[model samples]
Target: MSGPFVYVPPVNPVNYPPSPVHYHNSPYLASFYTDPNSPFIPPLSLSGNASPYQSPNTLNSPLPTVLTPNAVPFPASSSGSAFAPENPWNRERRVSWNGSVAAPTVPNSSWLQPPMYHYRRRSDAAAFPFQQPVDWTSLSPYAPYRTELVQQSFIHPLLNAEDRRNDLILDMSCPSFAPMRNIGNNQTAPITPEELNQLAFYPQAYGAHIYCELIPDLPIDIRYRPLPGYSPIAPPLKVGDILAAIWNDMQLGISQEMWASLDENRELMISRAYTKRCKIWASRGFPSMRNAGVKKVDCLLGKVFFRGLVPTGDEANTLRMIVA
Candidate 1:
């Protein structure tokens, strides 16, 4: 279904009246020269130009001129005697429509006063209608309110649980936050090195790569490379923990940088080991181990060790030499 449509009318230009004329009271100011009560005496040249005893009726004012047709519509003002030079004969002529209207009249009210069409606003000065006080106790605290409060007294317990859940599941889907297996209060026998060495043999035919070159003195050959598993011990160990263990055992002196390089190659092996471990545990109806995230596993052999080493694909010979 379609939504409702609205039609709006266009507006027209409004008409306004011409502005009232404004008279500058300068004309009467010049008359002060003849009055003795004036604080400023007129200059001699100005006094000489001024006429002595001219009757008000003898004054001849020029016809009011239009300064601006639409905007001002009024002539500038001058002293009553200023017209003397223009009308030297002093004949009082009716320039305005009515002789009595020669001077402009001031309006009783301002032009900006509200128009007659405008309704005057009657303010309600009295206080707002009294409202009865609410009995808040009668209303449940859990009642829904659209307004949010800052530092409100009541906190919803669900909010904390939601925050914890958000921290766990980034995409809000599966049980990503499950704890690691054998990590809780339960205790189990630790894996031994003998078992690890036994498990290191690859039953699936790729195992030959793992044995150390039994003939390191033999010039390195092609096709029989070391099938280096992620680590000497199975079950992914933290690269640091493994290096520390090696240092503690005092078997070989390998630097952290060498270990770092080994881990890079070790990642694929580590992933495979974890996959195998997970399958075994699952088949036994045991809980799966949680991923501790991919860790860097470095090699003990320095780059110098493999300087001229090449692959030699003689499995029977290599296995005999390696097993020896």
Candidate 2:
């Protein structure tokens, strides 16, 4: 009680019994007393100067000293903190944003030459072949008719020459010369030979026959006709004369000079020639050109032969016509 009071926990009787217990009548005397057979108990002390008892093993061992931030020694290269110079083993390898290993910082290194890229040159032999030159004369309206005759001479083994020629002429006749079929009935009355012969005088029909020979693949409804109100400004020629000129020009190739002379008025000349022909056919007691439902067929023959003319208002709405 003379020094600072130290709390001592009561010894557990089950774990650390001081001595054997005995029954005694005297209340003042302790019921438990130290027995000679029991283990010895050390006396407790309360003195200020006395040291706490320790086991021999603990007394012989050195105590561990706690490290403080300032007391801790760092590597020579470090800043004397927990964040020391990074260990070479723990240092992360540098990489590029593209996931490639970054190049070393050393300049002009042996491995640092610019990347090699190879490009193959194209060979002259591999180049595309030039197309064969087109024959402008072959596009003439009479070309197919002439070709048919030539082909017939070689190929017709069954028919006699006279019979073959007659058949060819009959086949070459334009379908436009035939009478219009009734819409309600598929059957058409057979044409008399006289009617077919009389219809031959019409230049429009004749032109159509030639035009059909020129472009057999064109639909019957879309076969050629003259533009509505065209008139020849330069060389004033009749319909028959114009037709003859065209046929002759086709036989002998059209000259650049002729085209240059015609200039912007070529379409007008072509149109006027066709219009005059249609008028002549109409005046001669032949069915009027308008009666043949030819209004929709305003394609000029000159327009078909020429290239790069601006499309008319009506033509602009339709797909472009491909020149032969």
Q: Best candidate per TM-score, number?
A: 2
**Per-residue lDDT of model 2, residues 66-113, tens digit only:** 544223334453655433555545668785477778776543432444
lDDT of 2: 0.29
> Which regions of candidate 1 fall more than 4 Å away from where they truly are?
1-259, 263-266, 291-324
Q: Model 1: which ten-residue window has the lowest total lDDT?
A: 168-177
Candidate 2 Cα errors over 4 Å, as ranges: 1-266, 290-324
Give lDDT tens digits, candidate 1, residues 1-324: 987976533423211111111212121112111211011111224343365343222245334335422232123324433222343445697765644555654334434333334334336524545644455434432333344554312111111122222111111001121111121223212222222222211121221221234223221111212233323332321212211221222112233564365455564554564455445445544453333222111121221111111224465212211110
> Which pairs clash in the backbone of model 2?
none
Q: What Cα-based lDDT does every candidate model obtain?
A: 0.26, 0.29
After TM-score superposition, the amount by which residue 218's alpha carbon in candidate 2 deviates from its true location, in angstroms, is: 4.6
Global CA lDDT computed for model 1: 0.26
**Candidate 2 vs. truth: CA RMSD?**
54.6
